[model samples]
Each structure stands twice: as C-alpha cells, then as structure tokens.
Target: MNRVLAFDLAPKKDYIEYINRGREERIGTMKVSDDYVRQCEKAKEIQGLWNPDVGDWIYSYGSRSIEKVFGEVTMRYTKVWLPVQEDLQAILRYETPLVMLQAFNDWLYTDSGYGCVNGARFHSMQELWLAFVMWERFSKVWDGKDWKVV
Candidate 1:
C-alpha cells in the first residue's frame, strides 16, 4: 500500500496564532470571516471535511502517533517529508532522503533547517502545486518504473 504522511515544523508561536485564528472564526455566535471561510474551504479540498470535533481531536492527539509511524516507515522508504527540524535532522543523521516542505510565506519553519537534507529546499507554490510536484516525482520511483528504489 502507498502511504503518505505530513507534519508541520511551525514554531509554537505560529501554531498558536493559527489556532487562535481558528478559535476566533468559530467563537461566540459570530459568523466566520470570508477569508477564514476561504481558508477552510481550501483545507477541506485537501483533507476533506471530517467533523469539527473529530478534526480537533486529531490535531490534539494525532501528531505524536503520526510521528511514531513516520519513524517506523523511515527505515523502509527513501523519500520522506518531515515537519519538525529535530525529526528531520534525526532522519538525515541516518542518511535518509528527506524533503523539507516549507510554506513560501510562512514565518515559522522558514529558517529552521534549510541545509539539513542532501537535496532539500523550500516549496514556494500554492498547496495544489506543491502536492502535484511532490507526487509527480514520488510516483516515478515509488511505482518502480522510471527510477530505482533505494
């Protein structure tokens, strides 16, 4: 089976800001802002609309679980995307092929570990473009067609 996973390397401050924005958009019987609505629509396009409560629970409890899974899989796969700088470094210390995906305009994770990977860099495109390029390269090797698996 093909499995894909992602994490956020965002600093605590930036993560707090995003969570605060989500809270404000959802609080006190107020309608969400058009910008926030657009943002949510975009996220829904990618992750789909899980129930809000379930989504929040996943955000709260799923990160560590996902990390453990990623750690286990890193032993088997060459291409991996890591969110935290520490985890990325750990993976690289073992000489794994890792790609660090950063938001072009993000304040957090912008300068965290720019030179850690052998062929790593920031992705400065819309989310859809980022996903497209990632998969385009990944499929070639993962499907055992164009490139050799490591």
Candidate 2:
C-alpha cells in the first residue's frame, strides 16, 4: 500500500550516497518529491473539500510550514517524501523493531547528548554542521515546551 510520509532535507552528497548505497544493495533508486502532496491538497482545496482534519493534514504534511519559515541554507533542510518499495520496506520492517531496542543506548551515545528527539548522534563537527545545515531549514524546533514555527 502507498503511504504519505515526511522526510528531512539532507545534502546532495548524502542523497547521492544513499542512491549509491541503494543501487549497490539492489534497493533501486529513491524517489522523493512533494508534487503529489501539493497536487492532492490543491485539488481538494479547489473543490472546497477541506475540513479541520484535512486542513491539519495539509498544514503538517512534509513539515511544510517549518521548511518555508526556516528557509534553506540556514539549517539546510527541505522535506521530501516518497514510496518505499517492497525490497526497501522489507529491510526497514526488519530493522525498525531492532532499532527500537537500542533506544536507551542511542540516547546515551551522542557526542553532545543533544539534537533531534529521535536521538541521532553526531560524531564529528562536520556531522554537526550538516545537521545544522539540514535543520536550519526547519522554521521551528520543539523548544521542549511548545512549537514555535517562525
């Protein structure tokens, strides 16, 4: 089944790397875009088909507000969404559960013990810089209390 998802904007280098890795591993090329997302919303909006739930979904989809407000290059992020094929899905399904088991370890493993809540640990200044570059694009961050999207 197809599903809509939001993903953070990473660098061209990382994107290329991901593509390369996928190809080498027979994962196929990745497709990430928001054209379909925008098209769906536009179609619904034009038909006056929006409700609170639909409105919320559109607003939150792809971190649209965060990407627009934060501006790329500052944090260097843009939202991307794409389908996960069966081959890729299989790998993700197998790994997702096991990944959760190390949640505690991940939290304590970061070099600085800070960053995204999913608990990604940066091991180098370049990694930190890349994260800032990626995140600098998000308009707001969850300041532990509330979301400030401007």
Best by TM-score: 1
Question: Candidate 2: where are CA atoms >4 Å away?
Answer: 1-56, 60-96, 112-150
List of clashing residue pairs for candidate 2 = 70-139, 75-133, 75-136, 75-137, 76-133, 76-134
Model 2 lDDT on a 0 to 1 scale:
0.29
Alpha-carbon error at 115 in model 1, in Å?
17
The per-model lDDT (C-alpha) reads 0.25, 0.29
**Cα RMSDs, all models:** 16.2, 17.8
What digit string (tens of lDDT, one per residue) describes model 2 on residues 80-145?
222223221232233464663354245334543245443344433323332232233333322333
TM-score of model 1 (CA atoms): 0.19
Candidate 2's TM-score: 0.17
- Residue-by-residue lDDT tens digits, candidate 1, 121-147: 322222223223223333211111222
